[model samples]
Target: MAYLRQVVKTQSIDIALINETHCGPRDTSTATDVKTILDAGEAVLTAGDWKAKDPHWNATKTSPRGTQLLHDADALAFEVIGPDVPTHYPDQTAWVPDTIDLVVYRGFPGRIALDVLVDEFLSDHQMVVAELSDSTPSTTPTQPRRTIDWSVFQTTLDAAPSLPTPSNAQEIDDTAVKLTSLIQNALTAATTTENPKIIEDRLPGRLMKLIAEKRTLRRQWQASRCPRQKADLNCLALKVRRALEDHAKTSWETTVDDATTDWVRLHRLCRSLNGPLKHHDGSYIYSASSRAELFADHLETQFQPNPAKDPMRARRIETAAEDLMRQRIPAEEDPIYISPSAVFRAARLQRAPGPDGIPNLALRHLSKRMLASNGRVPRHGKGLRQSLARRVTRESEDSGTTTEA
Candidate 1:
């Protein structure tokens, strides 16, 4: 009880129920145990269930524990919301499982969708699963991941305006970076797409379908009490059971296969299994070439040069030679360096291709080439940042020279 109290307090549990408590006739003080468990004060609600060992008492007046629960509910302002369904079904002969599971709601009254999963025979007592919600049940669609093309991103970076004129180098560089990002975004828009897996493959949908079918059959058999009808219903139930089992087995295998590191096969599998990227209007692009064209169109729209007569929005820092001294980083000093590390960090992994069909991974590989080129000081170079900028631009041009083996 102390342990449960600590757990509830730490985890902020609103409603808690205990099963198989064995709070029997010999137990001296139930108050101490209850207080120890629900010591979080009036914040949390708790409940326990008990059953009469002997068959002498009727069902309603069976256990003192149930009476205790009712007392607690009234005192603690808890609600015992239910349709009074039998929690435990009857077993073989006179041996019936006890309804020893107690449910309590801390907040306002609401219906609890509780159902016994008979197919899952966990123990002598059947497992009951409950979903707590204010509204009706919700069905969430399952989404499946698809592969992305990364190789084309580097190629796009190659064409994006890298070697801007050093006069106002900062503005030109910013424009170039934005343009590059827009193209990559467009590429990703084309290359990466998702398909929603049918809900029938997973969870309560399939299970519920089978359960409904089985129940319908059971009801029909109960109504008719005919041997031929019972046999047919039994066969259908067996078929549904087999299907459910097969779904569970295959779903596990599929998940395992997806987790494998075989990228090429996975890519091919995804492509084969899923459809192409959808347009802005939700129309699908069927072919890779079409996807590329769509990306190109988007890139043209997004990366188009600034509108004519757009304001520069810059104030001149120095008007006179005397005021020039106060200007930050004298115009003569080297322009601020954008490090190779920064560029590499910006190049995200598993990204889709750029407008030129080069991936971010491929662009990332060129960080070495940029660093190497920038290592040596050029004799004619005015500033370190400008020189590095030129080198990066040069590297972009040369990226197409060598093919990745």
Candidate 2:
């Protein structure tokens, strides 16, 4: 039994069949020993004794312990034959083959059989044979081809040219028009809408008015103060400028308080001034100080000092400024020239001047500026020369006259 289990392990067959042990039917000692061998080998066990009747053979439950043996040779034979057995073999009776008790059991697909019967009458002992069937279906179908309408296909081909091609100019124009309308409508809606709840109900508009008054006071203080105080005033002015720019760009629903907080800082600065600042045009400065002082303070803070103030720093600033200006201003001559016809068409379609001596046309304004500067605007000399030559040739032909060059 140990040798049979070793053979099953080494050979790798699915089921192990043991036959002709020559053991007593009543004792079950050989079956117990075989089961112990099978348990150690991790294989299922089924057994039969040729001497035993009725039950034939039965497979034991697979487990770590040895399988329980049974005396049932007939039952084991029925399991071996499965459902494909005929009622009788040749002229033999149903129970004629009593000596040939079969026992069959299944295991993992790779276990080898221990011993098997080969039919000595046919060849040697009874042999176990396995046959495999290729149950796959055929790929090709046994059918004829279906007809398609050639006229329908031809009609589709003929209709292809009539389909609309995409137009980029039309799409761009539509997008531009839509964007313009949307912006205009949004602006109009913003103007018409009431103030949001937070701004409208909370401060009673007094906080915003106070902030504006404070900013005015600060501007006045900055204008009146001496050169030392100018830097602080300038910083305040910059903050104000940024705030105003932000306010301008903001949506209408933005709160007045949120928009005007920078103004409050300017107001605090103005309150520090000695007196109200007066303007050159006789208007009072934002605070109590003369207009000249205010203007001087503004210049001191905003404008960089001349080279005389600090020669090296001034020179560096001047060079940087020159480079910046050069970059900002376009070249006098465009690298890509415009066609004369396009320019002429643009000039011709320009609007006329208004009643207030204001030239509504861009070309007329440019021409006026050019004339005032004593600059010569380009004219089509070639066209004029061509027209003159044509006129001379027409006159000479009509009069039948010729001149030698």
Candidate 3:
């Protein structure tokens, strides 16, 4: 059992099968022992698809074992997959080769593309090889982040045509589109696309070598079935398990320390470590879209205003703000204007690109004439949306300033 865990960890096996378990009617000792190992192993290893209280596991716990027919259905929703050929080969003591090996999986049926028996002569039983393919669909498509070279980006932008100044609302829209496109093109020319780095195993050479030795011992014990060989294998398995535990602890500590200052990184790391997300009903969230929807729903619920609180008070405050804006506005349309200095200051700030995808760096390096023109206020209800204009008007009224607007 310990050697089984070693194989799963070293090989990064997502699913495993154990054959020749020697569990049958009137004797479930071996099966019970395996379950015990699994109970403990899951803590240090990855969790299994089946739960402890699964109907199949509970029903078969102490029941007399019967031969599992090919058409037998699994109560726990696991599908049994078997090769068309025999897998077990008895030594000279028996002439017939029997099919005792089977694979049980609970996932998308199309995931496993092939299930074949391989004659490797490693043991009496031929190895069962299952090939899996990633055919599941994802909701959101991810784009690789472009790694921009600031110096190259600056040079590219400098070599491009001068930004055009806009005089009206239509021109403003066109100019924004053109500016965003130019920045995007410059970013493409001066950048390389690379996906985020994933963490890999960094186990020490000594530990890796020990794992290899353990594998060799496991194979030897399986072949010989000698008490001495078993003892040696057991001793080595204990050592390997302890070493793996220590290495895991150290790795976790290091990861936490490095991620301390970056909450986003820390959050991602924790999610990866915690296994798959489950729905409120206990089923696993498989599709990326499903997980995303679940999160969105949860956030929506959290941000919703409390029904128990005063709803009238909120409406009154909003009404007061709207009334004040109406009272302060002049009969004639006088638009708000952002000074050139203010625009320059805003463009100089280090921030992410807006919804238009225009980065601050692009705005900062744009021509002074274009910047001044862009800062000029458009006629009321022309350049900005009504809601945005109202917000700005109310803010200006509160500040006792109308020239800025």
Q: Please give the clash total of every predicted structure, in order.
A: 11, 33, 2
Off by over 4 Å in 2: 1-20, 24-31, 44-95, 104-405
Instruction: List lDDT for all candidates, in order.
Output: 0.53, 0.40, 0.57
Q: Residues 1-405, candidate 2, lDDT per residue (tens digit)?
A: 668657756876444454333344355454445444344433344544333333222222221111222332232321232112211111212224322233434343332222332111111123433221122211222244333333443333333322222234454345434433432332333233333343323332544454444344444554465664455545654555555555445533354445456787556444444344444443445444555677887899899753487788778988999999889666798688799998887885644554433223222323232232212111223344567789999998877755542
Q: TM-score of each candidate?
A: 0.28, 0.18, 0.38
What is the per-residue lDDT of model 3 for residues 124-234, given as tens digits with 9 covering 90 to 100? 556656555444322223467777677777677667776555555677777767766767787778779888675765679998888667656666667678899878877
Q: Which residue pairs in model 3 clash with each other?
A: 335-405, 336-405
How displaced is residue 24 in candidate 3, in Å?
22
For candidate 3, what is the total of clashing residue pairs? 2
Output the worst ten-in-a-row residue range by lDDT, candidate 3.
45-54
Q: Go through the candidates in order and give the C-alpha RMSD of each one to the true structure.
A: 25.7, 46.6, 17.7
How would you encode candidate 1's per-residue C-alpha lDDT over 271-341 as one tens digit per residue?
55564566665455668898899889989999976544534332232245548767776478667989999
Best by TM-score: 3
Instruction: Tell me the deviation in Å of residue 221 in model 2.
Output: 99
Strongest candidate by lDDT: 3
